[model samples]
Target: MSLNFHTMHDKNPDIVASLARLHEHHFGARPTVITGLQGDGSDRQIFRLSSDANEPVIGIYGPNRRENEAFISFSRALHQHAIPVPIIYTYDADAHIYLESDLGDVTLLEWSNQHDDSSSVLTMYRQVISWLPKVQLTSKDSIDYTKCHPFAAFRREAMQFDLDYFQSSFLSRFLRIRLDNAALANDFNLLIAHLLRAPFDAFMYRDFQSKNIMICNEQPFFIDYQSGRKGALQYDVASLLFDANVNLSHSFREAMLEFYIRETMRYIPIQEKKFLTFYYDFALLRMLQALAAFSFLVFQKGKSYFMKSIPNALQNIAFLLTQDDCMLRRLPELRRLFEEDVLNNPQALS
Candidate 1:
């Protein structure tokens, strides 16, 4: 059966059709329907295809050329190194479509949301950390830090998001206040400088939050991990622990970090004190980036979900800012910005 490429809401039909053809050619039967799944920070779309009762399921991804190529290559490389990513069945590079074995139904986000006690959730997350050292060891030679954008680039992206969305929409349109405050801009610049100067580098998952991880067969399975690149080693750790969506407590996060350190030591030797420094610096950077993201989503994307999480994002940033000496120096300005724009502004708080 043929499917229209444009009729589907958020996917490229041409890619979908190509994937259908590829599946039919390989499996000798077409999928019943391509059901859309939640997406991440890219223009890619994911779909699951269910086959006959006796046959296994197939996972299809429609990513752009660069991302699609990287995922296909990375999956193969990681698979060779015993990482638990989805097994790729076939890839049609010309059409930007690839098929992989379905891991299972439950995502870490869904699993965590369902359980009242977070112990089981943390256990599974610890398993994920166990896998990271292997990921680091295997991909060490393959990971290209030069290809990965640096903290400086991230700061630029955040500023663009702020200027285009938060400053233009919220400060000007919503609050009727022109964003001509030089002092506020300077404070933001200082914060950006602090982030860029922070130290650390390793394979970064770019987006290693709960939602991107799946719990298949009671194990933490990673997804939306195609953006993995050379970055601060602690970036993923900070992303997972200080996640605005999951809201894990400080005590739990610290324990988890300790757990990660112990497990990572099994494969590689890392100094406890030096690793902690990276962890703190990366945490501060991640928090700042998230602050920019929350602001962008609310003011530019008109997303109310992100708006609700703004306070939590700010709190995380404040917590991290207080921990580091470099960030501590800029705490007064940061507090001023938060109070004036976030806390005191009742409308934004809402």
Candidate 2:
């Protein structure tokens, strides 16, 4: 499971020379500064490259060629639809290097933290909600699904992958919970069926959380959407609304989910009752997916910073489980296991 990308020091000759060439070609002058940016949990390398005369630009060295290609292609498609994604300036596929427009350092999470007032945060969220439909619905028919990484759409197999990962990585390895594979598979089937009931002919931003949202020029610009594909609209909504670390209030989630519904109505017709039912189910499924991912990055990828979210993810799961009438309440064995670990151990999801 080695990610196929090489990491280099800032002064590494090959990296500097390659980025210098891209900067020289795109900016008409060699970059005078090549400052490395703070890295993320992933293996990708990022830098801010610029000259005194030109605006700063981002330089990326991705580990997986296919993932890079998926992102580059998706960026081009979304930009054509006037989405505020970074414009790809130039790239060298062989070198795994690409340059993009610099969207300064502010993320929506950071922005929200700066504005402590709930009203201000709500306003910013409304602004972001305004764009969610455009990203999910408007560009659905225009983009090529073939270029989507891993899967062209969120299907049964994709849903199963999350459950399987949760069992193997999170439940067994982290929580050390012995699971009944046959019984859990039945619950998995019900979960997948519940999720697929929603209309899914829209673009799904696979990682639409606050961290991927860049607040530039007083507006939100989306990034890290190389994982986009056709899927249920509720999935991305669930991702943002129940994001593990954010801890949005119950009232805020209610208001925002309503705001989202209104905005989404402008694009497509949806039944309120059915959508809400599916939304909560998707939220549960999303929490499981988050736990799976956080554990994967921490254990398999060796990105220990990912552990920061495990507690909140477990909290979200606990809150979701409190609904006595939800889909998860039907799966007794699996539900018991989650409750045992989460309730017994306050931190680290036990």
lDDT of each: 0.65, 0.84
lDDT (Cα) of model 1: 0.65
Q: Give a tens-digit lDDT track for model 1, residues 1-350.
A: 64323336866666667777788877888876677666544456677775553255555665466676666766777777778887888888777777887877787777888988777777777888788766766675665443343222243554344434544444555556544467656766665555555343455567788777878888777776666665456677778888877778888898999988888778777888876745665565566566556665656666657776666766776576556543534546445655566556666556
Worst 10 residues of 1 by lDDT: 146-155
Where does model 2 exceed 4 Å of error? 1-13, 346-350
Which residue pairs show collisions in model 2? none
The pairs that clash in candidate 1 are 5-13
